[model samples]
Target chain A: MEYAYYPGCSLEYSGKPYDKSIREVFKALGVKLRDIKDWNCCGATMYVSIDKIVACSVAARNLALAQNMGCDICAPCNSCYTILRKVNRYLAYDPEMRGKILEVLKAANLTYDTPVDVRHPLDILVNDVGLDTIKEAAPYRFDGLKVAPYYGCQLVRPEHHFDDVDDPMTMDNLLTALGADVVPFASKVRCCGGSLMTTCEEVALDLNNSILKDAEDNGAEIMVTACALCQMNLEGYQKKINKRYSQKHNMPIVFFSQLIGLALGVNPKRLGLQSMLVKPKNLKLIPKGMKVEA
Target chain B: MPSIPPIPEPKRQREADLREAFLKEVAGIPAGEKIKNCIQCGTCTATCPVSRWMDITPRETVALFRAGMLEEILESRTIWICASCYSCTVRCPMGIQVTDLLYALKRLATDKKIYPSRFPAHALSDTFISSLYRFGRIYELELGLRYFLKTHPLKLLANIGFGLLMIIKGRMAILPKRIKKANEVKAIINRAKELEGV
Candidate 1:
């Protein structure tokens, strides 16, 4: 399968590992990912909160570009996925908003002919490329590594067209297929308090602390998430959370793509494993240069 | 002890004009009309992760909007503190789209310039949007510098250690990656502003 990939700003900066692992895993699975040329920011919640019309127009520009490519766009970041999908839905449903957005697009010499399906990489992996195919591509299994599959809030909430909002199963199913022990984590679909870390440290840290405590209590050696912001908040702010809560929770947070890439026997460095703030100690399970004994 | 005499009622009554004006303003924005459908249920507050920190909970924010207490709600930090996680929207029993309602409140606050001056979120959002406008993409370095300078210059000094570590790890790029036709993006933004009558 082929897709037009839209790696938003986060993937290029703080979320590089996700971008790297996404590319590596797709290559291993014989899938083609074409970059959406000259793509800009997806306006995230920040832009939308400041100005809804401009945010929608900016997102519409991306869809117009993807429509030109004639392939669905796959966004790895949950924020990007949520915003792009929102613009698509709004332009289709609200005629007044559509008229305003189209006027802006016309000035820029762009047109969104039809609504392009905005997909998350997890959706593509499970729905487009079957789990069996992923299993077959993996030359090695995880050796029963315990993982807490965190979906965060954006991917499944508000408009849960693809998965159940309350109880998502795609991440769990995918991880299980890769031979990892998927924990029945209760905070799987909870909010990670994205961007609040900058504005309100106390609240953001408290919410993140709860998520970590739950994952660790569930016996998860590592927490894998599909959203970049969730990974950053949970992993990057571990020390601050520890200091605030007076608890030592050193669980490593990694991207779901990184876990899949490891199972597919792809090189660890290619997946940007070393860049993780908290390294997964169980990474020793997959030894260096180890190959499947076919 | 002798009982005190009953106090007389005040002569003047506060007009409901504030509520009427707020309702009219919200009606002009997309999805803002749904605020009228609120059922006063507290599910939104219960599901909110940071409701404890907010002065007015999501449920109460809607209630305040319904009651036409716009000035009080605007003065509170509840709207700015919302993380836009959408948990409340998903669990809202009335299907009121509480998160978008909060966003509408934020936009209203920003328009009236009613938010706190030293609000870090406002600085961050302004820096992010301005960076996007200038370069057609977010320049992390530029955004970081601008946000720190505007909100907390001393915090920038404290965060230097972490910033250096990220740079060493190749996590942050000093320069932004610009789009090919950035002028076109600027045109789109300008046209959008005109379209919105901003």
Candidate 2:
């Protein structure tokens, strides 16, 4: 299957591992991800909070570009996925919003006729690609590696299009299919407080602390997530959370795509494993002598 | 975090226009007006991860909003503290768009220029938009530096080591990768702003 891939800004930068692994994993599965040329930001959560019309109009620009590719667009970032989906929802339901976005697009000399479907990598892998396909395609296994699936908030909540919001099993099921010991994490669908890590440090820290504490308490050796912000917040500020809460949280947070890549026997460097702040101490390589972690 | 002022007591005639504006805009959000169905069950507040940081609970924000106390809701730290996790939105018994309403409230407060003084979250939004307009994509390093400089310079100084580490690890770019159609993107945004202003 082919998709117009829109890697939101975070994936292009701090979330590079997510972007890299997503591309590599899809390639291994023989799926095509065509980059949406000249795609800009999806306006993220900040844009909607400031100006909804402006945000939708900006997001519409990306959709218009993706439509040029004549296929549904796949966005890896949870925020981008949600924002793009939201704009589509608004376009279909809210005529006023639709009219304004159209007007703005018209001024830019662009037109978006068909609304494109924005799919997450998880949805594509577990649902569309199917576990059976992955089972055959994947040559390696987690070998009972302990993992906690952190869905973050945006992927499943506010809309239950693909997975259950509170008790999502898409990632858990996918990991199990890859031979990992999927740990039961109660706060799996919890918030990471996103940019508040920089904005409101203490409050954001508290939120991250609880998430990390749960994963650790659940006996997870590492945490895997789909959202860029979730990975960044949980992994980067883990040091601060440990300092403040005085709890030892050394679990490595990596993208689900990265873990999938490893299980598929893709090169660890290609998956950006070395970029993690906290190294994956418990990860074991399938072929032996190739593990990047401690 | 900026210190939120004490919640305002209702001054009826003086703030009717504010309430009307909030209601009209909020009505446009999907199931947004279902806030009227809120039974003050505190489900939203209970679901919120950072509700303790909020001056007004999510349920109370709706109660005050439905009671036409727009100023009090606006003045509270509740909206800013909302990470927009949507845990409350999906779990609300009345199907209220609790988180979406909070987004609307944030925009309204920003438009009126009346949020708590020096609110850092506002700086984050400001820096993100400015970066988006300039390069058509967010430059993470620059966004973080600008955000800290605007909101907390001392923290920026403290994190210099970590910043360098990020760059060395190739996780962050030293310079932004500009989109070829930045001008085109800017034109769309500018036009949208003008059209919305009307």
Candidate 3:
């Protein structure tokens, strides 16, 4: 499978592990990901609230750039995916808005025929790569692992397309294919409080703590998320809370791709395991040179 | 020696800071101009989730801004209660970006030490900032435990069982991870902080 991957701003700056693991896992699976050429931030989290027209125009510029590249757009970040998908859906469904958007895009010397498909990485892997293909590539089975697959807020919310937004099974199915156990939890659809962490920390943290508490309470060994911000809010913030409270939670977080990389018997170093904040001691079922520090 | 009570904010001075800081913080909002053109429409207030929780309405928030009554508005706990749902943004007839302005107010309040409490929100913000600073990214395990330790230290024992289980399962690694280009990340964060005047 080939895709024009859009990691967005967060992935480029703070989501390096997600970026590395995603590329590594995809490569191991014989999939090719070409990042969108000269892309800019998709004004979803704040711009949309600050200015609607400018936000839509920012998103439109990226979409037009992807469409020009002549391939489907695959966004790994949930906010990026939501903005692109929302804008594309609007352009397709609303002709008047489409005309207005085109007028705005004219300044950038671009026009939208809606050239490329906008998909999340999960949709590409499950829908295009197929489970059977993934199963064949698994060198190690996750027979004993119980993973809590968290989709966060953006992947399936606001509109239904690809899978059930309320409760997604794609990640669960993908993990099961790798031979890992899936811990069913209700916090999957819960919001990570969005960019409230930037503007309002209390609400965002409480919401994050609640979700983490629920995931831990539900017996999830770890939380696997596709959204980079969700991963950051859930994983990166845990240690500060731990140190202040004089506690520790060894619940390591991994991108879906990194786990797949482990299942496929790839080198742990190549999968960017060292980039994780909550480091897990026991990495996988494989007896490879995968380092585990307790 | 007598223990000092929490310092009370001077009403007039707080009001002035609230007005000036709010305007400075929300300066980037495109809808800021339209906010002054508001015709007393209740559309934004009707759509706000925090409306029922606080005395200040969304329209009233903008009204306060127009009247230079920002200090009283800031003193209220209502700023912390907004969810930033964008529902008000979508409904405003005057196209005022109430949600974005709310964020500006929060940034100002937090930076100026105007917060009401540290039990939940302030502590969470500290963690959020630390996570980004520690690892150029998010780590779920760290975030959860940190919240427990800071907000409810007594609950620390609860996560020990899971922590041990994770270790036994070979899923948890104890060593902290760092970016290969740590200084580059530090620079980025510094730049953002400088932009926010922090």
Candidate 4:
């Protein structure tokens, strides 16, 4: 499968592991990812919170760019995927806004009249790439490596287009197919407070505390998520989470793609596993070293 | 002199206007909401993970909007406190897009500029939008620096250690990449603002 990739801002920065792993995994799966040229941020939750028209326009520009690619736009970041998908839906559903979005796009010499298929990598990996094909490429079995699949809030909520909103099992099933022990994970769909970590520290930390505690108590050796922000919020803020809660949480939060990359025999360094804030302690069972074209 | 209760704001017209205004304020509201079908059941409140922190619970946010309590809704921290989790949006039996409604409310509050200066999250949106236009992409380092400087200088100092660790670990991209079409992005944004005429 070929896709127009939108890595968004988080993936280029704090969520670098997601970018690296996603690319490596997709490459190993025989999928081609084309970068959307001069793509802007998807306006995110912040822009929408500020101005609906501006945010919609900002998101629309990328959809416009991807339209020429003649393929679905696949984003690893949940916010990017959600914003792109939501804005596209908004443009299609409301004629008035759609007209305005068209005019706004014209200002940049762009146009988008069709619905954009903004896909999450997990959705693409499972449905588009198919689990059977993914399993066939795997050289390493997880040996029931206790894993927690954290879906965060955006990828499957508001619109359960690809998975169940309340109890999503796509990630759970995908990891299981790789021979990892998927935990019950009560907080799988829970919020990690997202950007709220920067603004409302206590609230975000409290939320992360529950997520970390839930996974740890449930016997998860590591937590894998599809959202860049979720990974960064949970893993990036571990020190603060530990300090605030007075709990020693040395959990290795990883991108779901990295786990797949490991199973596919991609080198840990290529998966950006070495950069994890809390080093991965449970990946010993999986063999590494795939000759990647990076 | 009889103390007239300020005639209560023409109750019905203002309520209609808020709903009608919402149709234009944000996308996702065009299909219309069964907001009138809301039984004040507080289902949205129960589903909201951040309800406890909100000054105006999700249930009241709807009720107040219907009641034309724009002042109360605007002043309350409920709109900003929302994490946009959409748990409430999914659970609302009335099919009210509660999260999108909050986004509309945030747009309204931002336009009126009534939110307190110390409100931390408010700084996030405009700065983020501005950065989106400026570089055609986000510069997280600058965004974080500006956010903390505006909201809490102490947090900025606290984050230095964390920032250093991230850079060392190769997770933090210290530099922001400016897109080649930044001018076009700015032009489009400016044109959008003019067209929006907010």
Candidate 5:
């Protein structure tokens, strides 16, 4: 299957591992991802808060570009997925706003004709690729490694088109099919406080601390998430959270793609595993001296 | 004990005027009129992670808006403190769009210039937008440095160790990845701003 990939800004920087692993895993699965040419930022939650019309217009530009490719777009970042989906829904429902946005896009020589679907990678992997195929493609098993699947808020909420917002099970079921033990994580859909980590540090820290603590309490050795911002907030800020709360949780937060890559026998280096701030200590799960043949 | 004269109560006419102005402002925002549907259910406040830090609870903020107390809500620290997580928006039984209302209040606060100066959260929003406008993509290092310099230089110095760690780990790039044909992005932004009359 072929799809247009919009990695968004985070995947280039803080979310590099996600970007790398997703590409590798998709390649292994024989799905072709053509990068959306000349894509700009998705105008994340921050831009939307400042100016809704400008944010929607910015996202609309990316959609118009993807429409040129004649393929449905797959965005790995939840913020990008959420914003793009919201803008599409807004333009589809509100003709007044659509007219205004169209005028702005006309200045850039672009037009969005509602040509394609904007999907998150998780949605494509679970729904389109199918779990049976993922299970069949795996060369290695997780061997009962306990994983907490964090969906975060954006992927499911404010719109429930993909999965059940409150009780999402796509990630959980996908991991289980890959031979990992999926923990009953209660805060799966909780907000990671996103950009608030830089904006309101205390609140963001508190919210993250709760998620980490819940995962730990449920006996999860590692946390797997689909969104770049959620992984960044949950993993990147653990040090500060431990310092502030005097807690001793050291769980490694990993992208779902990284775990799938490992199961599919992709090289660890290709997935950018070493770049994680909190390294997964369960590397011992992989049999010693076993590596993917080049 | 000596009898004290009764304190004069707030005039009813002034209260009505404030309420009317608040309603008018709410009507001006897109989908903002749904805020009047709020039943004072504290679901929003309960769902909010940072409600403890808010000067006015999300439920109370809606009530204030409904009462036409625009000045009080506009001057509140609550709007600035909102994390925009949208937990409250998803959980609201009345489907009040609590998070969007907070964004509306934030815009109003920014327009009135009433938010606390040197507030890092508020400054972060402006810095983020400016970075997007200038480069068509956010430059993380530039955004971080600019935010620190403007919000808290001393704290910036304190966080240099962690920043350096990020650089060493290759989590951050010293240079920004710019989009090709940046002029197109600029044109889109400029046109959108003009459309908004801002």
Candidate 6:
């Protein structure tokens, strides 16, 4: 399978591990990520709230760029995925908005036909790669470790359109197929308190603590999420919470793709597992019979 | 940590009344077309994680919207509890978008200065300020450290530990800098101010 890629600004910088691992894992599974030439930021989280026209124009710039290349686009960041999807759906139905966005794009020498499909990397793997291939590729089954599949805000929220905004179990099913036990948690759609971490540290810490607490309460040793922002928010903040509060809990938050890569026999170091703040302690947690070569 | 004072009742009203301004601010959005069509079906409430801890439901907030009780919806602590799940929009029978409404409400709430969100969401503006003030782009390490410094100073030390670990792993850059067009980014922020008139 092939897709036009919109890495957004974050993926190129601090989120390089996410970009690196996603490419390696997908390539190992025989998928291609064709970078969308001349792409810009999705306005991060501010454009949506601050300005509709600018947000749509910025997101459409990437989509128009991808459509020009004749490929469906994939956004690894949850915010980017939401922005692209929102603009794609918004411009598709609203002619006036579409016209305005197109006019804005024309000034930048780009035209969007809304030809490209805006899909998350998770959707591509679960829907395109299929569970059978994933199961066949798994060198070790994640049998005993209980995991909570976190959908976070961007992917499921605005539940106006997209997959089930709540009780989303697609990732759970895929993970289950890879042989790990999945936990049924109600806070899957909860916010990881993203950029709020900066302006409001106290509140963001509480938000991060709440997510980790819920995961710990649910008996999950690891939390799996799709958005790099969510992963960073949860894992990075967990260390601070643990230290400040003198908390003993340390749940390793991982990208779903990294877990899938592990099951497929990819080395953890190669997948950037060592770089995570909340490192997985005690490999003995994995059931004895379900050991991957990694 | 310094204790934050509670919002005085009269001061709270000034803060609560800002939702009207937010609604007016977003009046031109084509996306806001369904604001009036919201049916209180409780799908958003059913899906909202914050509903468990807060006093009102997401569905009730929609009901307040349909009733033209904009102030009540904005003033509700439930508004602060919103995780921006968008579940309300996804499940709305009338297709009223609820998540963006919450975001706009947050802007209004913050403006009113009555919003008592003492935790994480409050840090967003600070993160943006640090990013804009230094590197044109956000520095996750600084943002992360600054965030932890609020309630958990010890966590800041832990972040340094993690940063050291990341550096040793060759994952993070020792020096954080802006990419090309750093000035253009500030222009975008300036443009937002011009448009919002804040």
TM-score of chain A of 3: 0.92
Candidate 3 Cα misplacement greater than 4 A, ranges: A243-248, A287-294, B1-198
Segments in model 6 whose C-alpha atoms lie over 4 Å from true places: A159-162, A243-246, A282-294, B1-31, B37-47, B50-83, B91-94, B105-198
What TM-score do all the candidates reach, one by one? 0.93, 0.95, 0.63, 0.94, 0.92, 0.76
**Model 2 native-contact share:** 0.79
Q: What is the C-alpha lDDT profile of model 1 across A215-236, one tens digit per residue?
A: 9999999999998889989998
lDDT of 4 by residue, A46-65 (tens): 98887888888988899999
Model 5, A28-69: lDDT tens per residue? 999999999988988887777677778889889999999878
Query: Considering TM-score, which of the candidate structures 4 and 5 is the better prediction for this target?
Result: 4
Ranking by DockQ: 4, 2, 1, 5, 6, 3
DockQ of 4: 0.75
Error of 2 at B22 (Å): 0.8
Q: List the pairs of residues colliding in candidate 2.
A: none
Decide which is better by TM-score, 4 or 6.
Answer: 4
The lowest-lDDT stretch of 10 consecutive residues in candidate 5 chain A is A285-294
Q: Which ten residues in a row have the lowest lDDT in candidate 4 chain A?
A: A285-294
Residue-level lDDT for B158 in candidate 3: 57
Cα lDDT, all candidates: 0.83, 0.88, 0.67, 0.85, 0.84, 0.69
Candidate 4 residues B6-85, lDDT tens each? 64556656546655666566435743566567789999889777889888899987788766677568778888889999
Better-scoring candidate (lDDT), 1 or 4: 4
Across residues B29-135, which tens digit of lDDT does each residue of candidate 6 receive?
44676777665567778755456656668777767665556666655666655555565666677776677777667666555554543444444444545564346
lDDT of 2 by residue, A103-189 (tens): 899877899888899999899988889999997877777766899999999999789989998999999999998878898899999
Cα error, candidate 5, residue A152 (Å): 1.0
The Cα RMSD across the true interface for model 2 is 0.9
Better of 1 and 3 by lDDT: 1
How many steric overlaps does candidate 1 have?
0
